[model samples]
Target: MAMFVHLTAAANTPRIRRAGIRADSRGQGGVRGVYCFPVLPSYTLTHQWLRELARFGPKGALSAVHVRLADAQEVLVGHYRDRAKDAQQWLTAAEAVARVAAQPDPRGWEVVVPRAIGAREVHRIRAVPQVAGWRYLPGAHGTRPCTCVGCRIRGEYGGRRLRERHPHPLDGPPPPVPVLLARIEAAGDPGDQAALLDALHWFGLRRRGPVDRLARLAAHPDPAVRRELVWAVQGWSTPGVAELLDPLAEDPHPDVREAVADVRELMDEQES
Candidate 1:
C-alpha cells in the first residue's frame, strides 16, 4: 500500500468525513482532480505541502486528509510546475512514491488524481499545524529576501522594507515617464524577460504612463510582454485606454486577446 496526504481547509473536515476529497480543478487545466503528496519515511517531507498550500488555501483552519492506495493504483506525478503545465506522465501508486522518495529536495513534487475519490478511499483525517512547510518558494529561507515587484504586493506587510533591504535587480519603482520609456526600450535583450516584466509592472502601478509609449509594447516579440501590456493598460485613468486596447483585442495570441477582453470589461465597469 502507498500512503498520500491532501491538505485542505479544516472547515471541510466534516464533509470530507462523508464524501472524501472530491476533485475540483483548483488551478490551470480542465482536469478535475485532487492534489496530494506521497507519505515518505521523512516526517517533514511527508507533509511538505502544508505551508505552501496554506499560502493559497482559503483562510482559517487547515488539515491533512490521509489517503491510502494500492501499490498498482495509477496516478500522475512530477515537478509542481510540470503538473501545472500538464507535462507529467501516469505512474503507478508505488512508482510515484518511489520517485518522490528518491528526490533530494522534493518540495515541489506533486501528485494529482484525475477524478473524484469516494469517501471510502480516505484512511483518516488528521489535524496538523496551520503553519508548516516552506513558503514563497521552496528553500526561500536560506536565500536573500526576494523583493521582486511581482513578489512584493503593495498591501502585503513589510513589503516596502523588504524591497529596501534586499532589492531585486529587476524590480523597483518606475522612473519618470521619459526615463522609464528609455529603460523599457533598452531592456530588449532576449534573455531579460524578468526585467521586461518588472518594467511592465511599473506601468500597471503608475497607471498614467503615456498610452502612446505603451502602445509600442504590442510589437514586442514575446506574447507574454504583449499580454502584460494589456494588463497594464487596464489601470489607465486616461480616456485613450480603449483606443490603445483595440489592437490588442485582435492580437494573434489567445492569452493576449484574453487580457484585452479583461481590460475592456474594466473599462465598461468604470463607465457604468
Candidate 2:
C-alpha cells in the first residue's frame, strides 16, 4: 500500500477514527474524493496544505490523517489549477507519488482519490503545526491586504472582517487597468482614488503593468494619495517601473519620497 496524508479539521478526528474519511464533493460536478498529499521524504512538502486548508475551519487545530492506499487504487492527480480547470488525469496511487515528487514547487498541486477511504486504510492521525505553508499565495504578506471578492473567500476562518473592512472595488467585473486608472484619475474623492490606486498594485504584480499612468500619480494633490501611489507601483517588475519610481523619489512630500525609497529597497531585497 502507498502512504498519503489527508489534512482535515482536528474536530473531525473522532469521526475519522470511527468511520474513516468519506469522500465529499470537493471536486467539480459534485465529484467526491478523498483529497490528500503523498507522504514524501520531506514532511513539509507532504502536508503542505496543513496551514492553507486550516483557513476554512474555525479557530481550531488541524490534524493530519495518515492514509494507506493500495498501490492499485485509482486516483486523480494534477496541479490544483488542473483540478480547477477540470483537467485532472487518472493515475495509480503510486503514480501520484511520483508525479508530485517530480515538481520543484508543488504547493498548489493535489491528488484526489475518487472514492472513500476505509478506516482500515487509515494508518494514523498526527498533530501538525497549525502554521505550515503560506496562505493566499507565497510571499502574500509582502503586499498589502487584498480586498477583491475572489481573494476573500466567504466563510474563511479568520481575516474576514479585516479583508472586508476596506472597500472592494473588485466586487464585480472590473474594468481593464487603463480604464480603471482613467476612472481613478477622474474620480472626485482623492481618498477613494487613493484606495483604488492601492488596489491596482496587485493587478499585474509580477507582470508588465501600466506604469506610465501610475507614474503620473507622483503629482497628485494629496500627499497621502501620493504615498499610496508609491505603494501601488511597488510590485511591478515592468521596464517602466524604475521610471515611475524615479519621479516619486523626488516627491514634494517627505512621506511620499520615503515610501519610494522603502519600496525600492524592499523590492531590491525581493529581487535579489
lDDT of each: 0.77, 0.73
Per-residue lDDT tens digits for candidate 1, residues 49-73, read 8877665556677898988888888
Best by TM-score: 1
Backbone collision tally, model 1: 0
- Candidate 2 pairs with clashing backbones: none
Per-prediction count of colliding residue pairs? Answer: 0, 0
Error of 2 at 221 (Å): 47
Clashing pairs in 1: none
List runs of model 2 lying over 4 Å from the truth: 83-86, 138-141, 153-167, 171-272
TM-score of each: 0.67, 0.57
In model 2, state the lDDT of residue 181.
64
| Alpha-carbon shift of residue 69 in model 1 (angstroms) | 3.3
lDDT of 2: 0.73
